[model samples]
Target: MPHQLAVTIRAALPAARVAEVSELLAEAGRKGVAGELFPFAEVTGVHFARLLVVPEGPPGADGAPVPASVVYMSEVDAPLQSHLTDLVRKAGEGLEKVFGHCDGYPTGSASVAARTAWLRAHRIPSAAFYVNTVGRGRQQILREARLREAIEEFLDQQGAALSGAPPSRIRAAVQEHVRGRPDLAWARSRPAPPALWWRIRQKAHLVALPVVALFLLPLLLFALPVWAVLLRLHELRDAPGRDRPDRRHLRELAACEDFGAQNPFTAVGSVKPGRFRRATLTAVLLVVDYGVRHFFNRGDLTGVKTIHFARWLFIDDKRRVLFASNYDGSLESYMDDFIDKVAWGLNAVFSNGLGYPRTRWLVLGGAKDELAFKNYLRCHQLPTHVWYSAYDDLTTATIDTNARIRAGLFADLGPAATRAWLALL
Candidate 1:
């Protein structure tokens, strides 16, 4: 399961300490997954992880500065509690060092249990979450990636000797190569299937959707006009964010970007005030959560496959939203993809945030207003202080490809299937 943890920096912390904390995180970012302070690889099952200090936005009605938060978020295979246990056990000293600067961290006790409890206390439940492919754990990914490389290496050494061979012959040779190697022997067998209860829940959710829709049909019809009127009224009077980001802010965001094949995006913005907007955003996220779990679990989110994991969470009494994603490619290309492929989906969720590009309905005309939408995103975007990826060399597409190759390695295949499998090499 993908999980996140966020803790607010103590507003009472001296300014000099905050600067030291920032420098510490920047140093970790430079060291990447193997940093001496917090080696991300030491804590297993994490696909991606990041530590960032993001603003909580402007002062509240009390006119006091809201503390900027130190967010430690990760996507892991096990349940969050289990992952946190591993995190504390493996990186106890490093975690204490980093989190000590934050508010609410137990000061006197440095025990693993105490640190884990604090992390649990500050945990934020995502309003919605997405994984490009469910059930693909870090261990499986690394193993299969190694499998692909070994097969490719074998093919290279055999060079052209198998060039004119039949598909079966080529596949047979590849299978033989894998079978003869101890390390690649795992690829000769299939992995365990998902648990029975998981399958049952998936099917049950699929079956229940239409039934629920039918039950709500009459109420929906009755409320349609009123809902439309309310939505249009809000849309007409809503403030649209059109301001350009400051040059220095843009530079700061860009500094940590484009360093790897994958990049981390963390943005926070105030939610549009009032019950109606909040309800609309809530409903949208509910539907998105359903669709991603039941529909988009197979590596695509509405034709956009670049994201490995993404999440949205409502924070600070639902007055603000935090959007974060681990995506492949440069940020420019990423924005273009959403604009070109799934602009309406962007409009659906983001239009409820303060200073978004205008939307006609809940799903149209917002992200389609490209320039304004990009500006809105840049304006809210925050610089990530540190980021890590388990497989920095692989993109989502490459991971899918590797999994497919592993899946077909020991399968009985027809000529067409064999040819397709060979093509994957």
Candidate 2:
């Protein structure tokens, strides 16, 4: 029995016109015909319409729906079920016709004839019609009525051919198409075979394989020596037997150490408590605790050489003298102690150097200790600079120096420093 698929008309289509289209679908289902109603909305603006109908039941069942499928109400008066396998095959042709006469009346006799021939060939049983008349006036109602009459006449003529088909089969076919079952649609739209060059091109990468190998050869050759040196350095630095070295290790190991020996008041490593005998002009860097010791050991300073306990000397180097210390102990108890001790010692150093040479002090505190450092600097009336260096070129610095660093000096520096120290580089 042809499946009796329920037909519905939605959108702004009139009640009478919708009933007429639904009656045509009901009659088609009773006569064992199978097809779809291209909703008024789908066909009204379109120059042509196409639909696919498949049989219901288990896969490979005998007379299981027309695997060949059908195309109904296309602009071209093609047969309903030609051996052509896929609806997509004729989509471009249909779209061309739809967009070609975009503004014309859609329900003329010539249009009706073409639509009837396509529907008759497809043997559609049930369909839902929808019209979107969001803006049209009374003229749209008349056009829909004419379209309904034409579609009913076509269904009536194809009634005899649909006689033996079960209504259930028709319903299932319509459901499958509406739900977009590609497997059922696949039999109708058999895809063309791949081009000959497609498979051959997959192997073309082999031809460029040698060139890629050659390009990487020089990089590998150059990288080997540098990598070996770095590996050796890593091994020496992290050797297992060595004692855990402290901040003074580097400075103690090097000979001819010059931590402000060139000028008075300029010291690189920790300074002990003592006054210099000579008329000194240098910056004194006092390392208070272990944290400050580590800051001096960083690569930028090379290594701590000496801690002149007494005299603060000033140097004539173009670069600013930075005194950095660390605060990593207990925040509540030792924090005030650390700040007071460090600040007093730094003030003394700055005061002693003021008479001889100009100097700047940089305190390196951990993330948690920044607040304490800021409060201490604020209380002491010492000029302070804040630096934030993070991912990419997001490094920033704000200096409280009376004189601003010149732009020309920063431009001479590399791109990284220029961006990082935009305020004072």
Candidate 3:
């Protein structure tokens, strides 16, 4: 469901400024991006743009999140390879679109064009990619227990095989392992379905919509004042963790209890598509949790950065599941944490119709749930993304970036936008 891409820009730019530049690039063209930013930053504008920096990673000096390279990952229905590079090139060109100026860097339009040419000529040296079609019964599969365990085990194995290895290794191994599997091949998103009764039902609401709007007129009058108070209250909250006011994450790493800490790695997997009803239900749940998830997670999660997690989930209209998450721990510890803390929860909510294992994961729902999840794991194996980040702070916090200053500017966008922005972190 998600077509992903990563390009390491070995530019002349310093890592700190590079991080800022990357943020700007990510924010470019997403006129529909919901979060607040300096009106000049253009983040709050809403438009149909795909592509975001996945879990802005690669910490630079002073604990700043300077990714080793800028990554442009998107969940677009279109073929990413065809246009993502171009979009990224365009993002690199329009400095004003993301930031407010073209000062402080050599990223002028001509320079950007030159850099784009350089990228094309040199070719991307290494990259990690994971994609699969959302199955027809993805939502239902996500709910299934037995199937979930199988999927997690497979993912874990995949990780193990490549953990701490080179990107070339991942590419070589995965290609070989899944050689016979046609399911994971790149493909277009599911086509639009024929209109159903839901359309008629939605049309019927047109008459009632006017009545509802009339009734809410009084509330609309008071909306601004109410919004003003909330916005002020939001300002009072602590700024985002991007500033690295206190690098608990760095401290955690220094004191990490695990023996022989693991290298940074990303794990990506997807579930097959599903029927329409499952798609509908998943959409409702996604909307419901948008705000709730945001309010609860304000900073690099205050201290969770110790694990150095940068993850996101995507469930499309076809009930396709695309999960991308990374962490700083050995395969063993990561798997242990998953089974102990995340497995059950994954099956419960995140899976949607992705289906068991591919969708559910761990399938360790309760004391009564089977231990099949454990059975699927081959601890000896490593799990690594196409390009496992040797950069531990690849997505860690940084002091160089100016995100903290702009965070408060975004405070007025409300919880959903906040949550959406956090997903980028």
Candidate 4:
């Protein structure tokens, strides 16, 4: 189940404009593909909903409207998100082409008031969604009292022209008398209203501040206790038996073993032809213990439930690697020992020679299995790749060979580390 984000648009607009914008919104809804569109007309106003599916979980199953987590408002009879503003602008351009010019004025006051009410209800973060009615360019200066008078007169004469006057009568009259230019023709214009600065200020003061405070308060409260625990753990780092053996020393010992003339496990260059490669690259490491399970389970099962580890490795030009280590049991009893040894081995290899060859390590659990590797990349910040696959049943020989290639064992480290690591050899 995926979480759903619902957005509602409310506006007072001419029926034609409302229908036009709604059609565009419906088109966008279809393109989103993951959600549904519902339009409702109330006595007070008209509204529509565009629901977006998020990957977490289904929002609400019942027929009732899902409580909106985020809202967007636009003056043109539709609610729009920041990402959809471009589409709205394109639609407006289409309208201008049909109407000749969209003078910044609303076609009707009811529509204007409805839009204002909707914007106020949503309390969007910015005013960029609002239309600018004042004409753009040189004629913008003409948008003042003089232009309003001229436009009103023009509309009046146009009404008269519809009452059986000659076609050229209104055109000649407008050009010769109203416009005072024989060649110029009158085009419809809609000048945008002045920007709503005071409303923006009020939103910052009333809505933004409170929301910001609410968001920060929980973080501050949780961080204090977590920080205290971390400080206590930091104090234990220097305690007895805490002095661990450096990995570089262990690698020296490993190097003494006659594996081959070519450093079999070194990250310096490509691995020897017959050597095995292990997939140990990881991005996130989730260490779960009995206590964590008990906390969630209310003292049901004991020991270790599952140890999940995520790794992303570049296998070759052909494929990318994503794997999870699913070890069942108490982490302290079995998994910790494995991690300690593996970390020692990895540290020895990397420190003795150079940095790790793999790109990233992801430490995560709970729902890692549910994620399609490519889909995960789409929503996450991991580097891009052409293809990804799960390597759950990889053989030891294949795994080791792939590891060597992916780890860049044959590649030389810097001169300093290479000289040091290979010095003993």
Candidate 5:
């Protein structure tokens, strides 16, 4: 549920205002919280948010430069309208201040309703999105996190007395301890189930794929060979991006990293020319979206699970793309995991970029050319101006463990099951 807002800066605006915008976001990013103008934390249900200005990226295949734009991103609970309403109510001044630099913004005195409409107007729909856990919400994550902490404290205090006890007895004792604490009373009730409409939509999405595939089988049979030939010809001729990122650019990017357990990445690049690459990119994104919505909803994204949230969006009329992700650990490890575990996935989509490392068969050889791939990524990377996280201290793995502990806190279990549950502690 990350909302992407991209508004082009007016060519008429003076350079000083742009510098001011960056400074404002820098202060907020350093604080890791909302500013007086924009109380982002005041907006309910936001797990992560960022504001960054994307400069003109590399030229398109047609030699056109992508215009500089300001992007606002946030991952929040569903019913995004409610969050938007809260944002306008609490941060309207800040919205005006930041977006006012961009074209088509309402005047400073514009009504809240008008500003909200403008925001919705400028919104860009993500082509694909990934959530660490599909049904988890901000409040639930925080509450479960606290539950884990309290349980850990209890175990520390009672370790001697509970020594060698059966897992069931230990679990029962933990339940009793939780019941006695009024602050933890909320966990006594089951969390609300996902809404009926969402469940129906997910099922419909999964069901539609096979039906559509079956309907298109004959078309695919004829198109597959042509597609293969076109892909190979493009792969053979396309220039692989291999130059290292500028040192100053790397320094600016490094300034915003390693400040916490999570880091935000934003990168933008041009799409390759012509209908063939564009069509292939579209098809790949559709397939990726389907798999993420259905098969990968639990936790892992094809066996890599460090990401909290990620999104892909097309810009400049599909001539350019901006990819953003909120992930755990250092950037090096994150890149390593992608290269070693999901290189094919990287190739399937990124191979369509203008200067990507050459790919073979749309899913091989691209990201496998490790140095060139890394350089390609670095060359396109943009430094985030402001990045905020609701639970920066906890990671995807920690969150999953916490949720499991809460789920088993009041459940009945056999010895083996109980032992497994206790091991989660």
Candidate 6:
């Protein structure tokens, strides 16, 4: 019964003000949270990501959805009725500068009329709008559990009916079984008690982590020049894929009408990572994701509509460290923000992975090859791109809602076709 709830407010602004509005939300999120760290490393429900609504329309001759409403969104976790109300009021203040006046969606905890209005608007199909920003990690796990259970239940119910059924028939029958009762496969939400490791890590990081980062800074800096030389040498060793990128992915992205704004140019690139640090690719990505994803969630970067979705398996990763993300601006601008804002931490992590001077210069993009990697991204990236939907979409959101639940249900369901059917639901 304890679901993630948030008082989502929508303010329509001119499309041009997306960046300015996003910055205000981030600033407000920081101030709203007041640097209040949650217990352990739990996600604070106090902040939210941007939701740029692509107006419903056909793409122009150029093949991009005509920009429509630029709605600012954040689902702050309001625990108490009073708190939710106040947060709504405070959020309105953030919107005023952009929307001017109190013209944005005005639903507040303190006001009965406003609250009732918002509720009335979402009376039907009420899953998308939320008030809290809890992480979907547990929800995702539980959802997968539910999907598997549903698959099992469907198989059992159709035991006699399925014996002579063809693949298509079996899939259709399973879909009929789960229809409006998708809840049959879902697990109830569980209480989130902070784990021991969380407690220890948080405590240690509070005092020790920063000092350690500072301590490691000079050494990381000193190794930069040496790292640059090695990365450049590596790029020379292994060149770009001779098979010109077919833009096969562009067709896929082109069909997508799910996000607010897009760069249209999708870059698909890969690097044959050096040996010494290649093993830790995932570990590094996760650590960095943990540290910086919040910044991203708080709108730290711009033109990042639907951050990393449809992350083409090969789009960002398919063996040998492939990465991808959409940007609001040009690739160069994206790289600049990345280096200035995020690269310091990434560089330090690379230092740790490559073992700094002990192993010395084996890591590409470790210290100085940041641009070298940028060049690689530029070269290999798809020249044009498209996305199907944004995270806010109920359909796409459900895909990862349980962390790719359809994929998880594959074993129990037997055929991928059956799993695919369930996913489409």
Q: Tell me, by lDDT, which candidate is best.
A: 5
lDDT of each: 0.81, 0.27, 0.34, 0.27, 0.82, 0.39
Candidate 3 backbone overlaps, count: 46
Q: What lDDT does candidate 3 reach at residue 60?
A: 33
- For model 6, the superposed segments whose C-alpha errors exceed 4 Å read 1-228, 235-243, 247-249, 257-270, 276-287, 290-297, 302-319, 322-425
Q: Kindly list the per-residue Cα lDDT of model 4 for residues 153-254, writing each as its tens digit.
A: 664766755456543343344334534533222222233432466335434555564577588998869876765464344323312111232456344323
Q: What TM-score fits each model?
A: 0.92, 0.14, 0.29, 0.19, 0.92, 0.29
lDDT of 2 by residue, 1-425 (tens): 01001111111223334334333433433442322222322222222222212111122225332121111222111122331222323232432222222222133333444443333342322211111111111222233333334333543565575456554433233334423634333222222322445425424544454567588989869976875565344323421111233335332212111211121111222121123311111322322222232332221121222211112111112111223221112223333443444544444333232121111221222112435333322222211111011111111111111012222221234555543433321
In TM-score terms, candidate 6 sits at 0.29
Look at candidate 1 and tell me the lDDT of residue 159: 76
lDDT tens string, model 6, 50-128?
A: 3233222334347764433333323333343543345334444333353442234543333645743543342221111
Candidate 6, which ten residues in sequence have the lowest lDDT sum?
A: 124-133
For lDDT, candidate 3 versus 4, the one ahead is 3
Q: Give the winner by TM-score: 4 or 5.
A: 5
Flag regions of model 3 displaced more than 4 Å: 1-273, 284-293, 298-309, 313-319, 342-344, 353-371, 374-425
State the lDDT of candidate 3 residue by residue for 1-425, as single tens digits: 22123222222344455557554543432332322222212321111122222332323336665333323222222232434345444445332333222223334445545544544442332212211221112122122222223333554777766577754444344334434345422211232321455335434654564577689989868885764464344323413111221345333233322222334333222232224334433543443233223322232322234332233333222323233334445545555656555555444433333222332122334212324333223211112211222222322232112132123222344555544433332
Candidate 6 lDDT for residue 212: 76
Deviation from native of the Cα of residue 242 in model 5, angstroms: 3.0
Backbone clashes in each candidate structure, one number apiece? 1, 52, 46, 41, 0, 23
Error of 1 at 287 (Å): 0.6
Candidate 1 per-residue lDDT, tens place, 1-425, comes to: 22222222222233446677777787776666435666778787778877776664666668776666667888877566678888888766666666777776865656777877888888887888888887777888899899999999999988789888888998899999888999777787776655567768778988897789899999989987897899999999988976999999998888789887899998998889888998889888988888887889788998899999998888777778888999999999999999999998898899999899888878889998888999999999988867778998899999999999999998888899999999999
